[model samples]
Target chain A: MLKRTPLFEKHVAAGARMVEFGGWEMPVQYSGIIDEHNAVRQSVGLFDISHMGRLMVRGPQAEEFLQHVVTCDVSAIPLGQSNYGLLCRPDGGIVDDIFIYHLPDEFLVVINASNREKDWQWLHDHTEGFDVEIVSRSDRWAMLAVQGPGAEALLIQAEESGAGSLHDLPFHGVALSSIFGYTALVARTGYTGEDGFELFFDAVHAEEIWDKLVGLGAKPCGLGARDSLRFEPCLALYGHEINDDINPYEARLGWVVKLDKGDFVGREALVAIKAAGPSRRLTGFEMVGKGVARGDYPVHTLDGEPIGVVTTGMPAPSIGRPLGIAYVPTSLSAEGSEFDILIREKPVRARAIKMPFYKPRYKK
Target chain B: MSHNVPAELRYSKSDEWVRVEGDELVIGITDFAQDQLGDIVYLELPKVGQVIAPGEPFGVIESVKASSDLYAPVGGEVVAVNGDLDASQEAINTAPYGAGWLIRVRPSGDEEEGIMDAAGYAAFCEDRAH
Candidate 1:
């Protein structure tokens, strides 16, 4: 049986179409993709993100252990802040993209649901000498994302939280607080390209907070809208954009690879990768022809020579046009460079465009 | 099971529906098919005057998350297409039987042999559930 989140019942009650994703039965959509997607873009929306792995790393050598395992400069992260980082193999291939939240006592490492077991095992394999303990907080917490332009006002209107005026919380900042009388770790971070907050609270209170948020006009959105929201901003999705065979540089995630921080896993290979420059680059494109670009579609040159493959291609709801991301040779990845995407054996014309098809609306 | 399967129309196990009108066969994907592929955003149809074969793909449907083949239940020469769908494919989700119709075909006579009644298709769709 596929695993269900704490809010699974809520999703079913609202008539969401359930689908299997990352070994869990998740709600793909409720009120339809376009409607929910526009809801988040134009107003506030709520999402159940409990299916992701929630973990805590603590002990005397916790910081050192993380600094060695992840590519980010973990030592630089102050308490109440988080850093987006990646776990890489010795060959610099990406294991997963993670968010490391530096709390007062422990570090909260949020990982993808599909990579949860593998990431946990990877962490354990590296704990030979480090005086640290890795604890799975998945069962203890239910995660929710309150996102969009109006999210701040909704949070401010809510009662009883030590975070004290969400407007004061810096981007990527976390605060241990009480929300609606329940202890929660509220973080000003989200995957959507908008101002939002992710709350980690007790699993038992899933319905309580979810209902309250919905009552307060936060439209209940599902995975379909969530994927579209992230797609517009070109945020890297694991398994599609990044995988064990793809390095951070190839995935356009080199910014997260802090090599100067000294000797993390894959540091040797990443240093070489950065020096030599990546052979292929991840680039964005807009379809000029009449076909919707689908993932895994083969890409060919105008002369019919196959060059690369598409990672993600679709009609973006926000952009009002068909856009996609693909890994092509660095030579053909520049702006105005044209390629042919073979859709059903017919090559459709596409032109490489500047990345981040849509600008993010995060609070600066 | 709640999907609308009109009894007057014939269905193919591949989820396409056939409605015979005079010498022409009006075809569209079934409601069950639209539901299977949620929120159809794009539909690619064969050009008018093009020939098609039964059980072969004559079009493609791209939903929000997936892209699937739209097969021909009864093949013929394409005479007309729902061109307005090029801008808005959501009609396939909202009105799968009417405006969602893909192509109007001048039947090739030998193409309707393998189709089933609505009850048989509903049963087939139910069987796949388990």
Candidate 2:
């Protein structure tokens, strides 16, 4: 049986094309992916991201435990700040990528929905000697992502009914707010690379908040648009781009790994890999011809020798061109390097390019 | 749903449809499928004269949103392939049941199986909608 979110009825009423995503029956699109993607790019869109996992770690040892578990230094983070980090296995493989937010009394970690159970168990198993309590808040809360250029304006209107004004929140910041007469945790963070707010509220109040946002001109978006939008921004998806078999260095996420912060789960492996260097590196590519490069497509040299494989690919709606990310040998991973994508046993020319095929227009 | 599903064509559960044209069976994705996929941007059509087995992937169609495999509805030898999709790929999104026809194949002497008639295809879509 598939799990259902609080907004399941809302999605049905909106004519959403439903798909089973990570054990939850969620909308893949409503009006359409392109339409919803464009809506979030130009205006505002609301997404039922309650499927994403949320965990709270609270105690006198909260900051100290997080500093030891995650690769990033959570000790220096002031209250209301959030930092992107990764949980790595002992051998440097990524367990899961997460965002750690520092609240006054506790640290909140938002992780991928698919990895929620695994991550929760991993955290518990590793916390045997620690004094912190690792609690899963996913079932108790519902999340709504309000994203786009006009997100703040729409959120302000929704927050008028006791929801706090979102005006003071900055990027990567979190605050307590009220909406629809319910207290909620409002964070100015998003995966779409757009200025937006992710609201964590009581699961029962999700429908009312969803309707209110829709009534305020926030188009209801789905996983389809969410994928395209995040793809355009080069944000990494766990299963597609990063996984347990791949480490942070190979995924080009070395910035999120802090080896100097002392021993962590994967510190030794990351340190050795950092010293010797990664054999294969993840890089971006653009199809020079008229074909779409998809995942698992062979990356080959001009002479037809296999080099690597594409990890993620799509026709970017924001750029109006075909783009993808691939894992290529270090020698050929440089920007402007030329390669070919083997499509149907035929070589299609592709050029290695810098990531973030689309630059976001964040509010100043 | 003004989109038309011609009575002469046969459709597979995967949304591919086949119609007899001269000595070959012409195949394309259904109009309903195109409408759901939205804005066909690129097509990976199979090469001419390739042998394809039933339910095997012959090509892929990628839109701005997702990628879907184009499967062979019946085992056959590819006699012809759609080359026009290389340039004006929107033909699939605009007229999927017609100009978007993906390939033509000579049957491997087997009777058509697992195909739905026009009325059956419409009902199949209706069943999926619920």
Candidate 3:
């Protein structure tokens, strides 16, 4: 049985097409993927991201425990700041990509829904020696992201809490603000590569806040638009881009892995992997011929030799072109390299290109 | 929501509609199919004079969500193709039965006899939607 979010009935009433995603019956589209995607790019769009796991880690050893588990330097971030990081297995394979928010008393680790249980177990197994309390707030808290070029304006207009100027909040900053008569955690972070705010509040206020935002001319978007928006920015999905077998180095996320930081999970293996150099690297490619190269499609060389596999492929709605991310041999990872994506057992012409297929227009 | 099924047209189980004009038949995907496909960006149509077998794939239509094969409702030689779709594929979503017509074929067999009529096709679509 698939779980439903707090806004399930709201989505159905809005004529949204619901599909099972990450063990949850989520809305894939409301007013069509293209329209919702365009709304996020040109105006503002809202999303129900309540399915994401929220873990609260508190205690004296909180920062120390987090630094040991995550690849990013969590200790470097001050209070009310967030940093994107990755959790890895001892074998250097990614466990999951996460965003950690540093609050006044505790750290909030937001993770992908599909990896919630596995990540909790991984973190639990490593907490034998640390004096920390990891509490799962997955059911108690609901998340909503208001994203796009005009996101700040919509948020400020919709916020009824008399909160101070939200524009003053720097990127990746977080604040405890009163919204809709409830205390809400507003973070200047999002996966859409646009200027946005992710609001976290009690699950009971989910519908009220969502309705307030929508009433302010914010388009209600779904998972379909979320995927397209993130894809254009070349953001990695957990299972597709950084699974248990795909390391961060090969995923072009070496910057997140602080090898210089003293001792962490997967540190030794990553050092060895880095020294050996990744044999296969994830690269972006654009379809020069026809057809969308979907996930798991075989990528072949110009001479018909199979080199790599496509991770995520789709028509980039923002760019108005078909683009994909694939893992190919390091020799073929350069831009302008020609290759073929086997769609329906037939090789289709494609060429390697720079990623972030569409340049994100984020407000700095 | 209910789909639009014209009373004069015959339909295939794959959501394609066939309109017979004497010996020639005009083929296009139904409004239901286009709505399901959503935002079609490209259409691959068979060439004029190309012979197609009944129920055989004549071309492919791609949307941002999925790619669907455009099958021939009946065996025939393609006499006309809608080249306008090459420039504006949104016709499939806007005017699927008219401007979005995929191909015109001269029948070589009585394949239309096995197809469902308007009422039967509407029932079929309603059943599948549930």
Candidate 4:
């Protein structure tokens, strides 16, 4: 059986093409992927991301426990701020990539929908000695992401419908706010590389909030648009780009690993890998030919020798070109290096390029 | 939702439509399949003159979301291919049952026994719907 979110009926009414995504029956799109993707890129779109996991950790040992578990330093972040990080196994393999938000005495961790159960269990198993309360709040909240260039204006319009104006909210910041008479947590964060806000509210009130956002000119987007939008920005999806077999260093997420913090789950392995350097590195590529390079597609060197595999790829909605990310050998991971992507058993030429295939227009 | 399956056209379980042209069987994905796939970006087709077996993958259709294989509706020799897909792949989404005709095959014999008609395809789709 597939799980349904609070907005399942809303999706059905909107004529959404639903699919089973990570155990939850969710909308892949309503109108279309390109249409919804362009809507989010040029205007505003709302996404029901309530399937993602949310957990709250509190107590005197919350900070200590988090710092010892995640790759990013949790002690430095001030209240209302959020930082992206990764939770790793003892051998430096990534358990899950997540975002940690500091809120007063508690810390909230947002994780991928597919990795929720695994992450929750890992956290529990590792918290044997920590003086903190590890509570999973996945079911209590519903998340709506308003993303695009005009995201702020649409969100403000929705806010005026019930919630107060949020004009002073800083980027990557979080605050308690209200929408449609319901108290919600409003965070200025998103995966689409656009200026947006993620609103977390009671699950029961999700439909009302979603309808209000849609009525305010925010198109209801789905996982299809979400994937294209994030792909354009080179945003990593947990399963596609990173997994238990790959470590942070190989995934080019070493920047989040703070070895100086000491004794994290994967500290020793990360330290050794950092010293030895990564053998293979994640790099971005643009198809120079006609075909779209997708996940598991073989990436070959100039002489047609296979070097790596594409982790994610798609025709970028923003740039209107085929782009993908792959884990290539360190020697060939540099920008401007050319490679061949095997599409339909034929080698299509592609070049390694810098990330954020399309530049974001975020307000600094 | 339309239930407007035209009676003249033949359909496959995979949502492909067939129109008999002389001895050739012209094949194209149905409107329902294109609608489900959203915008079609690339269509990888089998080479002309290649022999295909029924239910065998002869090509792939890539959309913005994912790639799905295009199966041969009937066993035959590929007589013609849609070369226009190389440039205007979006035609599949716009006119799937018409200009998007992927391939034409000369069947080895008259073997339309397992294929579904338009009404049957509609029922098939309805049965598969969530």
What is the model-wide C-alpha lDDT for candidate 3? 0.90
Q: In angstroms, what RMSD does candidate 3 have relative to the true structure?
A: 1.4
Which candidate tops DockQ? 4
TM-score of chain A of each: 0.98, 0.97, 0.98, 0.96
Q: Report the poorest 10 consecutive residues by lDDT, candidate 2 chain A.
A: A157-166
The Cα local distance difference test for each model comes to 0.90, 0.87, 0.90, 0.87
TM-score of chain B of each: 0.94, 0.93, 0.95, 0.91
Rate residue A322 of model 3 by lDDT: 82
Worst 10 residues of 1 chain A by lDDT: A156-165
Q: What is the interface RMSD of candidate 4, in Å?
A: 1.0
- Name the top TM-score candidate: 3
Tens-digit lDDT track of model 1 for B9-127: 99997899999899899999999888878888877789999999988889888887778998888768999999988777888898999988889999887564558998998888888
TM-score of 3: 0.97
Q: In candidate 3, what are the lDDT values of residues A1-364, reduced to their tens digit?
A: 9998899999999988888899999999888889999999889999999999999999999999999999999989999999999999999999999999999999999999999999999999999789999999999999999998888887777656555568787899998877767888999999898899999999998998888889888899989889989988899998888899999999999999999989999999999999999999999999988788888999999889999999988888878888999999999899999899998888999999998787766666
lDDT of predicted model 2: 0.87
User: TM-score ranking from best to worst?
Assistant: 3, 1, 4, 2
Residue-level lDDT of model 4, residues A100-172, one tens digit each, is 9899889999999999899989998888788989888889888889998888877766663544456678887
The residue-by-residue lDDT of candidate 4 on B33-101, one tens digit each, is 888788987677889899988877788888987888887778899989999888898888888877778
Badly placed stretches (over 4 Å) of model 3 are: A161-164, B110-114
How well does candidate 3 score on lDDT at residue A307? 92
TM-score of 1: 0.96
CA displacement after TM-score superposition, residue A113 of candidate 3 (Å): 1.3
**Which DockQ-derived CAPRI band holds candidate 1?**
medium
Q: DockQ of candidates 1 onward, in order? A: 0.67, 0.59, 0.65, 0.70
